[model samples]
Target: MATQLDLQEQEQLDALKAFWKRYGNLVTWLLIAALAAYAGWNGWNYWQRDQALKASAMYDELDRAAAAGDADKTARIFGDLKDRYPGTAYAEQGGLAAAKVQFEKGQVDAAKASLTWVAANAAEDEYRTVARLRLAAVLAAAKQFDQALAELDAAKAAGFEALVADRRGDVLAAAGREAEARAAYEAAYKAMDDSVDYKRLIEAKLTALGAAPAPAAPAASGAAS
Candidate 1:
């Protein structure tokens, strides 16, 4: 009985060794890969948090400069903010604020440059649309009518469709295209929501332009072509 027990124990030990020999290297490499990935993920999270904190502080400085109407300081600080933290929402907001300050100071060219940058580079589509709208207004004021219309045509933000049409009417009217201006104003009036105060302003524009709003379609049929 004792000899039989010893033989059985030796067989079990040999089987365990064979299992380790077959899988030991694979297990070791898999564990190393998992640990490496975990460390990398943690490092990336820390890096993003650090970047955002620094960007927030810089944005606050830019905001203060803009509020104080310090165009030069606003421009300088915005330059730094955009260069160092272009990926942050702070950079986009700073660009818009800087543009507003410069525009108020009659630095039209500089304002255009800042607004163009935001239109091209903002991470959010809504910000891009706002930049484009402001840029179009500036271009129109400069009598660059075709360029203003081009900018408006390129703005595809859904909620801004009415505003874009309204701006287009203004540009077309400035260019002495009266028929097209009336049509554009009508389109703007139709696009605006009924409850918006701005819609009433749009209606007033249509009234002044001698363009009547399109009659509303029945509710069951919704909007008609």
Candidate 2:
């Protein structure tokens, strides 16, 4: 019986060897591929985190430059950040910050360029909307009324409807189109929550234009910026 058990164990061992002989190379290659894929996935995740960390640091530098009011330095570092890490949220944020500095420094064209980048490529929808609104404001300040109007009209988010209307009113008022301005102001008034002090301002705007302010409704939070 011991000899029989020994033979059974040896037979099992021999069968396993035969199976390995038949499929060992395929199994080994599959295991290697799986390990390589796992390693690649880990490497990619690490690289992404490393990139985000680097981008955050660069953005901090950009913020410092902005605080110092060095438009040139801010622009250069912002450009570097955008170019090197365009996909990072920090890059879009840097664009917004740099645009503000450029605008305050009276660099309209530079600010427009930065804002355009943020509008076009920002990863966050909120950032894109803010950039669009700011860009429209700048264009309106430059008296590019049609261009500003086009930007506002093309904006897809309903969240900024009131702000867009308010901006449109400003643009129309700048162009001395009082009737259109009144209409726009009314729209803004209607869109705003009645509780906001800004609604009173809009109402005053309508009164100045000799147009009755639209009846107040519950304010939707649709103001951009």
Candidate 3:
């Protein structure tokens, strides 16, 4: 009986040896490849996480600089953020923030540069829209009416049609094209939400251009600024 059990064990061991001899190299390589892939995936995730944390910290610093109204500091931090992390959301936010701060601080050229980068490079359409809109504002303020109108004309982002029309009206008004200004204002009035109080501001713009304001009245959160 013992001899029979020994024979059975030896037979099983020989079968396993044969299987290993046939498939060992393939199995070993497959296991190695799988481990390498898993390690690479983990490494990639860690890199992404590290990038996000860095971007967040830089954005926080930018926000602080903005709160202090230090245009030079804001510009420098934003420049670094854009240079190193242009692919991050924080970089886009930094551009917008820099543009706003620079514009307010009377740095028109710098403001335009920041807005232009956002207009051209922003990953999101809405950010591009806002950048174009604000860039038009800056240009219009400088009385570069044609350029301002061109920017607005090129803006096709969803949900920004009203804003674009409104800005177009401003540009036309500045250019002394009252008729076109009125038409643009009317378009803006129609495109905007009737329940939105900002419509009233658009109406006022129309009225100023000798056109009646929108019939439905609502309040405003922000208007053109």
Candidate 4:
């Protein structure tokens, strides 16, 4: 019985060795490739996190300079952030902060330039929308009417549609395009929720333009154009 058991054990060992000989090299290479890929992914994640941390620190410095009312420092720090980390959210935030500081200092051209950079290069969609809106406002104030309208027209955020329309109305009114201005004001007024205070302001604008709001339609059987 002992001899029989030894023979059975030897047979099993031989079978295992034969199986390994057939597939061992391929399995070994596959495992090595998988381990290499996992290590590469981890390295990339670590690199991205390190870059983001550094970008965030630079943004904090830019914010501090702006808070202290040092436009020159803000500008220099923001430029550094943009150059090193243009794809980081922190860089876009710095651009907005720099533009605000510049605007406060009556540097309209500089503010516009910063906003334009953010609008074009922001890594986040929301930040890009904000930059475009602020840039449009500055252009409107500068009486760059066509450029302001083009900016507003290119802005496509549903949440910002009403505000863009209102600003467009303002620009049109300034340009003495009374009819287009009235239409834009009407669109803004209709888009705003009834309970919003800004709705009242838009209504006032319509009133001032000698453009009365259209009467409410009956609940049923809506009129066709």
- On lDDT, the leading prediction is 3
Off by over 4 Å in 2: 2-30, 195-197, 214-225
Score every model by TM-score.
Answer: 0.85, 0.79, 0.81, 0.83
Q: Show the lowest summed lDDT stretch of 10 residues, model 2.
A: 210-219
**Number of the top TM-score candidate:** 1
* Residue-level lDDT tens digits of model 2 in 77-192: 99999999999999999999999999999999999999999999987778888888899899989989899888777666756788779888988898888889888888888898
Q: Which of the two, 3 or 4, has more TM-score?
A: 4
Worst ten-residue run, lDDT, model 1?
A: 213-222
Question: Model 4: what TM-score?
Answer: 0.83
lDDT digits (tens) for residues 105-160 of candidate 1: 99999899999999999999889998989999889889999999998888888789
What lDDT, from 0 to 1, does candidate 1 have? 0.90
Measured with C-alpha atoms, the lDDT of residue 45 in candidate 1 is 95
- Give lDDT: candidate 4, residue 112: 93
List residue ranges in candidate 3 displaced over 4 A. Answer: 1-33, 213-225
- Superposed by TM-score, candidate 2 places the C-alpha of residue 225 at a distance from the truth, in angstroms, of 48
- List, residue by residue over 137-158, the lDDT tens digit for candidate 4: 8898898999998988877766
